[model samples]
Target: MHDQARHGGAYIRIHVTKQGFDPLTQRLRWSDLEQVLDTGPFPDEGPTTDDPILDGVSYSFQVTAPGRTGRHIVYAVWRAGHADQNYYMCSDVRFPGGAPDPTTPPPSPPAPNDGCTAAYTPPGQWTGVSRAR
Candidate 1:
């Protein structure tokens, strides 16, 4: 998403609903909203028009789907800092497995010092884009 030179950053709010999104009526009301997934006050990473897949700054989040195997609609709202205008989008996703067990704890992480060395070299520096491998 493009920031369009907004000031502070952006706030990202994500909601999910089991109800299907109507293409003709591309608007959602508060009653149609279901679960609130993520709300982020993230840093400004500039425009993603420059190959977002290669080196775009982003925030990763995990969401809990409602059921085991069904389709769901995820709605994302982007509110720019110090701005009243907001951008909205809807995405359809299908789940293959049953719901996760909330009682089960997540797996442990790997050790910090696992005998790994770090080395990186940038391919080239563009006029306004910078990246590290």
Candidate 2:
């Protein structure tokens, strides 16, 4: 999903709900995951601006489901300035290729100690703010 601040700018953080993780009932730490982008105080107003600074910037990242598949949730938390207020949104996505066949047994969950971490590396540098048309 694509979004931008309409009034005061904000610092954005991205987080994904792990396959077995329950974001509704469980407490989530927004700082633990890697941030996809930090727009600082003035992010490009998406495609609405005539000469958007980050118009061409594209973000990509990989997610691991760990024996689970179907749909997952991604959260974007935008914290405006340094105030105590925080804004958040959720996007539900389905994995490619749809669900596994019913005849096929589901994969076993990994052992408690078997876990891995994935990091996102930005593909290009941000060119900072530009005059909005």
In model 1, how large is the Cα lDDT of residue 69? Answer: 56
Tens digits of per-residue lDDT for model 2 on 7-122? 34456666655555443334555543334445556443434434475333222335444443555566777675545567888776665544443675555555576568787657
Q: Which residue pairs show collisions in model 2? A: none
Query: Model 2's lDDT to the true fold?
Result: 0.52
lDDT of 1 by residue, 28-114 (tens): 566666666655576665445465445544445666655435445678888766667678878866566534335765555555897
Per-model CA lDDT versus the true structure: 0.60, 0.52
Residue 90, candidate 1: C-alpha displacement in angstroms: 0.6
Question: Could you estimate the TM-score for every candidate?
Answer: 0.46, 0.38
lDDT of 2 at 68: 39
Model 2 residue 10 CA deviation (Å) reads: 2.6
Q: What is the overall TM-score of model 1 with all chains considered together?
A: 0.46
